[model samples]
Target: MATGDEIWEALADFTEQCNNNKRLRKMQRDWTKILHFKAIDMDDSFTMKVVEGEIVKNDKGTVGTPDIIVETDSETMCDMFWGDINPTQKYLRGEIKVKGTQEDVMRIDVITAVIWPEV
Candidate 1:
């Protein structure tokens, strides 16, 4: 079981990584969104926002109206951020659950591919 701090750190790092990528920023330039992450294993939630192609993380809570909500175990989330595992695979296997419009979800997939491409 990953600790809450570990999960938060991983998520922070993940967002930072995405924000630092020129390709990612260019791709997400027009896609402003608020995302909510629910760590089922830790029973905690956090928020992240993408605006003007930059990622801004907010503390746990209903910071704003969410465009997408993701639910997954804390360990799985950590692994995904640390590049130890692929989120797309987990989602395909039903391990990670996401609630969002098809377009929104596809945007995330595209972002993930840019950062953590198949390896």
Candidate 2:
């Protein structure tokens, strides 16, 4: 299992990669939202905000009422950020729980797909 710090680092890298992807930038052009992630196992939480096609990480706990709330273990969170795991598959298997509008959920999936295309 990844530690809390490892998960944070992975998320940082993930956001950096997402920001650098033109397709992702175009996809999120007008979308602005905050996503709060709760690492259940670690009892830690972090927030990510998407504004003006850029992903900004805020590891200082919940910033505001997040548009999306994702609950999962630290290891899974790290794996997903590293593109080593498919979040949709995990969600389907009931390993990850998400609270948000369908569109927002799909947006998360889109980001994941763009970051780590299926092989």
Candidate 3:
């Protein structure tokens, strides 16, 4: 199994490369208009970046952070990163949870579709 840092690096590299893609670029630009919520597990700290918005810090000592927590439900993004694993299942299986506005959740769904397009 890949280590946490390895996965984050891969994702970061992929997103950086995607920045060069027209479609992805357009979507990223669009996303800037909306607030983004990113839950990053930084080895020893769990940092949340609100992208172009506000990011409130979490007190939890990070280490096992998720790649990104889309407030909304995006099976595609989940499947892409976590193949065959449904968010609902994870939730039911006591894995992931969210604490944000409903709008944040809804917007995240759209963002997920854009970020994790089937390549």
Candidate 4:
């Protein structure tokens, strides 16, 4: 299992990469979303806020109701951010679980696909 700090670092790096990608930023333009991630293996939770086209805030604890909630093990979460794992496949195989509307879920998928294509 990955440590909480490692997961945080991966998310920070991933967010920076996404912010630097103009295409990806445009793809998510006007989107304001709050995302909650639960790393079951590490017993850690994080909340991220995406406003306009950038991830503006990421904190160690859940702050409020999220538009999307993602549940997975810490290592898998780290791997996903590192572009070493395919979120779609993991979701299909029950390795990752998500709770959100279809559109919101697809939005998350789109972000992942645009920033970190399957490998």
Best by TM-score: 4
Against the reference, the lDDT scores of all candidates come to 0.84, 0.87, 0.39, 0.90
Kindly indicate the candidate among 1 and 4 with the higher TM-score: 4
Clash count for candidate 3 is 1
Score candidate 3 by lDDT: 0.39
Q: What tens digits encode model 3's per-residue C-alpha lDDT throughout 69-116?
A: 433223322242432344444444444455545655454444435545
- Clash list (residue pairs), candidate 4: none
Name the 10 consecutive residues with the lowest summed lDDT in model 1.
56-65
Cα misplacement distance, residue 10 of candidate 2 (Å): 0.2
Full ranking by lDDT:
4, 2, 1, 3
Alpha carbon lDDT at 76, candidate 1: 88
Candidate 4: C-alpha RMSD to true structure equals: 1.0
lDDT (Cα, tens digit) per residue for candidate 4, span 23-102: 98998998899999999887799999999878999999898889999999999999888778889999999999999999
Per-residue accuracy of model 1 over 10-99 as CA lDDT, tens digit each = 888888889899998998899999998888977788888889778866576557889999889889877877777877889899999999
The alpha-carbon lDDT assigned to residue 40 of candidate 4 equals 89
Cα distance off (Å), candidate 4, residue 86: 0.8
Error of 2 at 99 (Å): 0.3
Which candidate has the highest lDDT of all?
4
